[model samples]
Target: MASLGVFISCTSDAKKTNDKAKTVTAAGDTVATPEAEVGTVREPVDTAKYDALVKKMANGDTTGNWAGRKGPYPLAGAILPFKRIVVYYGNLHSKKMGALGEYAPKEMWSRLNQEVKHWEKADPSTPVQPGVHYIASVASGTPGTDGMYINRMGDKQIDSVLKIAKMQNAIVFLDIQVGLSTIQKELPRLEKYLKLPHVHLGIDPEFSMKDGSKPGKKIGTYDAADINYCSDFLAKLVRANNLPPKVFVVHRFTRKMVTNYKNIKLRPEVQVVMHMDGWGEPDLKIGTYRHFIFPEPVQFTGFKLFYKNDLKKAPNRLMTPEDLLKLKPVPMYIQYQ
Candidate 1:
């Protein structure tokens, strides 16, 4: 379950726009195309040189300045130099959620690689980090026998995403949408997965039933206390396992999706990202980011793209990688649904 903007339009204009663009994919397949033309056109990047630079940076060679910033924030043990992270979000079996779930797993990975490569070419200095974000706990309309309005995905389902993430050499995020369930009740169930070095966590406030209403009846909220609780939880795990700092993302588009922003604390072992998850035309999205996400700062920031919902309006255009990169405090994490 997500904000009302997420469910707005269901037109196939995005596909029509894709056809008109006739853009080629990195894998040599002409799949969905980029929405806008990038301004900078340069010689094809010397990837071998790029890879060598990456290796040097990994070895603690910090002589040259890199584009964007090598994170002071550590994800998966390495201080990733690039600020761009392109993530595909959804479950393999669900249709209501997104395009990540619309295709088979292998096909999905192929598409994800295409986006990753697109960002790599668009901003040669900031190589995109690929990730798979699975909605592990779905919000339910009815409270279950345990009185929790969240339905946890089976272990096999979680493992499937993990396996695919490993195939891409990418990180994995288990997203939670707590309906009536408290974070205390739902978070521990994913501890086994969280223990894995590459696995991170995401929480959606849209379905958080703070007032005992159903999941989709009204927009929900999570205060700073709740965020602090989750960060403390992850910090413990990071220290206990000697793993890198965990990436904790909170999904928001509306101001109310997350409350008491001033009080949200940061931890050495946890990187908090305030992700903009609203869907609409390009201008609306930028405005949403500017008003809701930009002014309120966090450890890091993320933006989400909805394959279908983003194109619901007629005469609409999607935001290109370059377009999003231009945002103030440019989003470090990018998710596609």
Candidate 2:
């Protein structure tokens, strides 16, 4: 559960749009060759680099839990220890949701780039990859017509986020807050966007409310079965489309958020990141990561820093990249809200 406070205000229309994303057309209005068909760019893994990455991922883990020996080497084009992902996370409709929607696109990208540079400088060895994590399905307070307390963002909104991310060639992660809905229902509708090469995925167990409880009433949970379903879904996409491996991020702050960690299967076509997403002072946040995240061995690790919620208490400051680099199994994916 999140030791947190952030209003998840969602106002986007649930109806999806029919227009093609910017990627589908050229300036002359000519239909471009789809990325999925043209992308046969899976590079074979190098053993030496893989070993070094495993070492960096371990970050001096005496327990030998990290650099998990799960599945297989990430299929070609996986972005992880080779490149640190720095992302702005939020919804475009509500400033309360996160930094991605709190500022203008220009201002947000500028601020995002600053942190990207910080990570780049802090760990000169691992370059930073910029990204935008948009909340595609926001858990809501009231159940809509579908009886699910969630507002789903249509293609138009997702396209706007894509345009912003393209500014820096940043990757995009569509985050889902399932509310009363299940992953089976939510993920398929967004397949058009997920099929895009530059786009990835994030599933928040924080808002997964599986027990018919309203969102924000209680923290929710996702069993390893839920996670395997998502990973399997992505792996099939990779094989069918011949696209590179996709990065799959799962948010967690408490052990209950993600149960049966060992049973969450992995694949070469998908890289799983168990992201620590609680908000509090530095000490509390660190403790949350150590207790809930570090102990369980996931494929890769991610850390989320709330720009506002994190500094509400003493030691009123954000965790700098330098400060975070000290963490065991240093986070390969860093998100700012």
Candidate 3:
């Protein structure tokens, strides 16, 4: 939470004049100014070649060329060689979770497969991993029996999504919306599922309720410490199970949702992807990505496309694979809600 006081304002204003220019970290917080330089200045990454590569990919040239390849990280385990991960985000029992939940199970899987095939046709060399990202733990507007402001799904529900992913040899992501509960409380409950090699995790900062407010009443946040705790938790699981590194995805659209990104520890056993979870027309979506996800550097990145929200505009269309491939750092993971 941002400090609220005259002192805080004064301090923020003081940073504006420092020789070490204030810059936004991946978490969207201003970096602290140091009294003196501590290390050699780093050169900016050259994206000219990367842009050309994606441009070619966008034009239907799959000839084994792509940027932001997700391999050699070794932490990704059997799902190695990261390519594009297209996920259907929703809950099987609720229509509000997203598009993935609105259709019949078989029909939903069919739609997901069709999208996967589309991407494969676009870029044969880059493998597209299909995923069903289920909201295993839902954030409730009212606090439940545990006063966590959350409602967790039963094992049967989780297994349903897991089974679908397995049928397609795809991966499963169990997303957590903590509400008034802390990660400490909600994450451990899902450890059993996360122990599986093919299963990963997603945390929604929008419903975190860092200030003890009800979910959906106001936006929430997750500090770097919270993120680190999740990483450390998953790293332990991988070590204990002798499994591959797990991907820890944290969804964010606004800057405040994630604070102090520089402090987020990247471990060999865990990969972090800062996912852009926003909804709008193509232009608004692109601007949000450029302003939020593009400037923030993390281990990896993801983009979310909302079927209903996206179609609210005149075009009434969702972004195609070609349209999204143009992003500078091609999203390693893409989600449809």
Best by the TM-score measure: 2
The sequence of per-residue lDDT tens digits that candidate 2 reaches over residues 68-126 is 45468887777765788899998888877788888999999899989888887888989
Could you tell me which 10 consecutive residues in candidate 1 have the lowest summed lDDT?
8-17
- Alpha-carbon RMSD to native, per candidate: 13.0, 5.9, 15.6
Clashing pairs in 1: none
> Which digits, one per residue and each the tens of the lDDT, describe model 3 over residues 268-318?
778788898888888888888777776666657788888777888786678
Each candidate's number of clashing pairs is 0, 0, 2
* C-alpha-based local distance difference test score of model 3: 0.70
Which sections of candidate 3 miss by over 4 Å? 1-72, 76-81
Residue pairs in collision within model 3: 70-82, 99-337
What is the TM-score of each predicted model, taking all chains together?
Answer: 0.78, 0.90, 0.77
- How do the residues 157-247 of candidate 1 rate in per-residue lDDT, one tens digit apiece? 7776766776666778899888888887789988877866667899999888899987888899999999999998999987776566677
- Give per-residue lDDT, candidate 3, residue 268: 70
Rate residue 320 of model 2 by lDDT. Answer: 90
Clashing pairs in 2: none
